[model samples]
Target: MGVFLAIPVSTESFGQKSFTIDFEEGNSFTVDFETSFSEGGECCGPYTIVERFNIDNYSYELIEPSFLPIFSTVYISNPD
Candidate 1:
């Protein structure tokens, strides 16, 4: 299943970013990117940064969890 999530981020200062997540019942997963880092990984800091999707909003159409190539903590961002 696929859905859209609206996460608002305010990156005005250190530790100032804040956002909310909503998902459908029984179809959401929560993944903490802070704990699952690979050794010598080139990625660091806010692995889940919020990127604006549309000019009027910052939403993302999440692909179904099973279809993903990698595994991570993902939460349902919408209602079922």
Candidate 2:
């Protein structure tokens, strides 16, 4: 018979904003992931803004559970 080990992996996103990872077994480590956001102008112009970030992975057991909000807003002047 062969022995097999099952590693538990869990993922959860707080408020649909950020992702949280939990590793049941193995050495503790962190990983960085890429995220992007886009904003549209509300004025008469088609102005937009884009932003990107490399967010680092965080352990759930190390910190308190909280919600992280990720959003972008664009403001433009209306010229008539």
Candidate 3:
């Protein structure tokens, strides 16, 4: 299953980026994900991507626990 999230845009900071999502029910919160690049083993590809939410301490308060995988801790391997 694919999860569709609605967020307008992101604001850049010194070492991080954050974006706010306003719900139709008049509830909204900001979600943040910090990106970094590093080398990894070939078995896991050449790099890794880890996605973390709630950097603003709001995502966990608004989103359900089970539906946070896509926005939470994720590992990615890309060969380009």
Candidate 4:
């Protein structure tokens, strides 16, 4: 004999930004972010400032698997 189970899943949104990332079981990846903004008076000149950063060699280890998996440890290298 076989048995079956049913579960309900729901998601809610409230005008917010969300992000999702996926990685292999035992792999590493790098991520970079760059942003710029300007500050000055509207009538005058607007000075612009830019900044950039990077995340290097990031990896996650899965310890257990369930509704949400637990990570054994998360590894992140130096940033530049």
Candidate No. with top TM-score? 3
lDDT of 1 by residue, 8-75 (tens): 33233222233334344433333221112222335643333322221112333334332112232233
Off by over 4 Å in 2: 1-16, 26-50, 57-80
Judge candidate 4 against the unseen true structure and give its global Cα lDDT, from 0 to 1: 0.35
lDDT of 3 by residue, 1-80 (tens): 33466543222222354777565666555566554444556775433233444544232433333221233422222223
Q: What is the TM-score of each candidate against the true structure?
A: 0.24, 0.20, 0.43, 0.22
Clashing pairs counted in every model: 18, 0, 0, 0
RMSD of 1: 11.6
Ten contiguous residues minimizing lDDT sum, candidate 2: 59-68
Candidate 3 TM-score to native: 0.43
Every candidate's lDDT: 0.30, 0.28, 0.42, 0.35
Model 2 Cα lDDT, one tens digit per residue, 1-80: 32232322223311112333344554233322232323334763332221222334322221211211323221222333
Instruction: Please give the lDDT score at residue 70 for candidate 2.
Output: 22
Give per-residue lDDT, candidate 4, residue 45: 54
Stretch of 10 with least lDDT, candidate 4: 7-16
Of 1 and 2, the candidate ranking higher by TM-score: 1
Which regions of candidate 4 deviate over 4 angstroms?
1-21, 30-34, 39-50, 58-80
Cα error, residue 51 of model 2, in Å, equals 1.7
Q: Could you arrange the candidates by lDDT from highest to lowest?
A: 3, 4, 1, 2
Winner on TM-score (2 vs 4): 4
lDDT, candidate 4, 1-80, per-residue tens: 32222222222211222223344555444433333334457785543232333345555443432221122344654343
